[model samples]
Target chain A: MKPWWIVVRKEVLESLRDRRTLLSALVMAPLFGPLMFSFSMQTMLKRGLDEQDKPLQVAVMGKEHAPNLVHWLESQGLEDVPAPKDVASIPAAVRDAKPRLVLVIGPDYGKRFRAAKAAGVKVYVDSSDQDSQRDFRRLDQLLQNYSSQTSALRLAARGVDPGIAQPVMLDEIDVSTPASRAQSLLAILSYFLLFSTLIGGMYVAIDATAGERERGSLEPLVSLPVSREALVAGKFVATMAFSGVSLVLTLASFAISLRFVPLESIGMSANLGPKVLTGVFLSLLPFVPLAAALLTLVASFARSFREAQSWMTGALLVPTLPIMVAAMTGMKPTALLMAVPSLSQHFLIARLLRDEAVPLTDGLLSAGGSLLLTGVLLVFVVRLWRREKLLG
Target chain B: MIHVTGLAKRFGTVEAVRDVSFTAPDGRITGLLGPNGAGKSTTLRLLYGALTPDRGEARVDGLLAGPEHTEARRQLGVLPHGAGLYPHLTARENIRYFGELHGMSGATLEKRIDELVAMLELGEAANRKTQGFSQGQKVKVGIARALVHSPRNLILDEPTNGLDVMAIRSLREVLRGLRAAGHCILFSSHVMQEVAALCDDVVIIAGGRVIASGTPEQLREQAGTTTLEDAFVKLLGSETAEVQS
Candidate 1:
């Protein structure tokens, strides 16, 4: 066997024996991402389902002025309640989580309806509240229906055709598939997947580099006949191997856990078939080497394992940038984006999940870019090792 | 043989080693005797290719020793200061790791490990992990790892700094046996009795410079003292006196 492979085997074997490294890097890191995703999805879905089953309560201030509207709301599964004494009290009630929807009907509502004029109905809701926001939309749709029905009755009383009031009939056709809509709502999926690939090898990389230096064995090992380049290559390969296993475990965990999420109830479909899983795995594979090399290079500068861990934690923010920016800007994946590293992999995973046909050229471009970066990073680490202060 | 000629190294503005030169010939044990901060560690580091010299060279068997000189490094085994064994690995595994790096593997590496384990009297500790090992046990493991590849030359920095008296006596015996086997061994120490007892030739260094080099008896005669320790003190005292003059 080559000297480098020997070094790699020793490092991997040593890390595997360390219970701390194995627990965090292999078992916990992979499981955390998928578990976090499923937990969050399940919570949000549960909230939405609960909101659907619960009755909506509308607080009306001038209930006497709009008996018909109140009656109409009651027929649509909305309960009527007397509003608080003052409009300002409505915000306090909402803050206390008392009522999510409130309706304010002025005394002039009766006069306006008798005179056939537009009457103002003020709806007070905490738009910041997610549940209140859903209920408010439902209440708004009900009021619109009541207005049209009342207008038609007035027209009938005047012996005029009710169709004269409606000049145009409009309908909306949504062409988006459940998977495509799910892609945006579940943007977190790609983030967690990429994060898993980046973090899975972190403990191994630090253990091989900074941990070796701390143990005082690095100088003896370096004094051997093997070249520094081979030493670095061996360590890098080990880290990448650990990361690949972590990625596989993470994807598998997500695949199994996602089945129980009830995504169809929310108009989102995520199919973790063998094909999609394979595609996501392949798309993330090219970046594993780059992540390992970059992490190892940065960690090599640290004087101790704890110091290296802190720097690695700070470095993790870099990978999260692409996803954060994409979310903030609602970035559409362009051809140029397909050539970027983390963004490209994220884009590919999303596309595969959405059932979009990702071209072979896109995959090749991303892979080539990642490999090129890995080569550069590996050379940089080798050079850093050659420096005298690295022993310190 | 190991030759370090006109070797000089500087750390920032401080001259850590200046004009250090010595030779440890085959079939002999050479001692580098000096007090703390006397550049003994720096000189050994240069000899083992752990540091580059700012001036001159270190030659192992006529080949220049430096980072890129793998051939010379293959001919040398180094146990640097405070060298540590992997606590998680057995003593045998630690020795085999270095052997593999030197391209010795399979049955040959195993045989070498067994021989070194017996020579160091580490039979009981050979199969166990090195964690929580005593100072003597740790040194035994380090020595085994250094000699795993059977290099022509060996450089050890303070091999007996923290060892017990019994451990030191056993280690001295091992060095004597290696000398009889025609291995060139160079080690650094400040203990007068240890140097007087084991070294065939001694190089005394102070302030990063080699002030004197000779057999222990010769050094005693040069200082007109019967004891090697007094002789070494007198030699250092004269050097300072001459610098003042």
Candidate 2:
């Protein structure tokens, strides 16, 4: 047997017996991503649906000044309540009612209406509050209707045509496909994928390097007749095995669970058929070897398993950061983005999920760039293993 | 034969081994005797290519030893200081892992493993994992791994330090057997009696330099003392010898 194969065999044999590593690679990592996706999407959709179904409750102050407008609002399903005596307490009253909005009318409301001027009215609700958003939009539309109707009546009284007052009308057109629209809801898939690829091989990588040192066996192991390259190569191969298995398993679980979600209701389809799964899995392959090599390098420099774990925990953010940044900014996927590691995988998976055929160059750039970086990291780790201080 | 010529090593500002030279000829048991922190482990490490000497070279079987000395290292079996057996692997697996690293595999490896296991008498624990091993059992496991490859030379550091009397006696017998088999064996120790009983020639090291080297009786005659312990103290000219049991 090749020297490195011996090392890999031993590592795999031991890691298979380790319950913690198995739990993370086979069970926890695969299960968590899909379950989290289903629960969060279900909750968000339920909240939006419930918000639209609820009655819009509004508190009207100085009702006599705007009785006609209030009657119009009531006819449109606005359940109005008498405003509290102290107008200053309107914001607090809105908070107490929870999701109910407050509408305040000033004393000059009657005068402003008679003079054919803008009415002094204030709407009290937290704009940042998610549940109050639908009620806020309803109130704004109601006031706008009242203003447009009054303007038309006044224009007719002056013997001028209301149509003459109108200019070019603006039309809104959305060109988003159902799959593209679902991208926002399914953005989290890339994060979990990146996480699995980065963290899947971490346990064995640390155990084979830092864990060996802590156990005091590294001295004898390094002193063996085998070249340092073969030893490191063996370890890298073993780590990649675990990492590959974990990445595939997690993605499979995520793809399977996505099918059960009621994505169609939200104008989205998560049909992770075999074709898309195969594409996603292939695009993500480059990251597994890269993650394995990078993790081994970091763990090799550490003196103990505990120390390696600390460094690994911090290092995990490197792969996760790009996806997070792209998600937060809602950045559109560009051809250039396919040249980066984690970011490129995110874009490729996004395109595949959207049922778009990815260009061959994009796939090559993503895989090639990641492999080049991994080569650099592998050389660094091999050099570290060759050092005498590696026994620490 | 293992020949270390003018070997010197330093870590930062502190010199571990300075101008140290020695030779353990074929079929002889040579002892490297030193006080605590006297560079014995560093010298052994340099001989086996675990460390690079800042000056000079350690040649194992005529080839200079260092990280690039794979040919020379293949002929050497080393029991490094504080090398622990893998707790998750059985005694046999631990031995086989190192044997495989040295290019021993299949029937050859299995045959060698059997011989070492029987020679060390590691019967029941041979199949059991090393987690529950006693101190003596652990040392025997280390010895078994070191010998599994059947190297031409053997280097062990403080092999009997933590063993009980019975274990030490058995270890001494094992070393004697290896020496009789024509393997060049060099081991380091702080205990005078252990060296006096096991070594054919004793090399006394103090402050990272060789202060004396000769047969046990010759060393005693040169120091003008009857006991090897008193002779070691006299040769070093220090009251801090503090010979271990």
| Tens-place lDDT digits, model 1, residues A1-392 | 99889988998888888888787668886788788788888898888789777778877788889898788788888987666778878888975557777798899999998899999999888888877888899999889998998899999999998889999877899988989988876667877876777687888889888888998888888788888889898989898888888888988999998998889988889877899999999999998888888888988889899999999888777777887888789988777777778888888988898899999999998898889888988889999899888888
lDDT of 2 at B47: 86
Task: Name the Cα RMSD for model 2.
Answer: 3.1
- Model 1 B-chain TM: 0.97
- List pairs with backbone clashes in candidate 1: none
Candidate 2 versus the native: TM-score? 0.93
Worst 10 residues of 1 chain A by lDDT: A93-102
lDDT of each: 0.87, 0.86
- Candidate 1 segments exceeding 4 Å error: A81-88, A144-170, B237-245
TM-scores of chain A across candidates: 0.92, 0.92
The TM-score that candidate 1 achieves is: 0.94
Kindly list the per-residue Cα lDDT of model 2 for residues A275-340, writing each as its tens digit. 988999999999998999989999998998899999999888888888878878987767667777
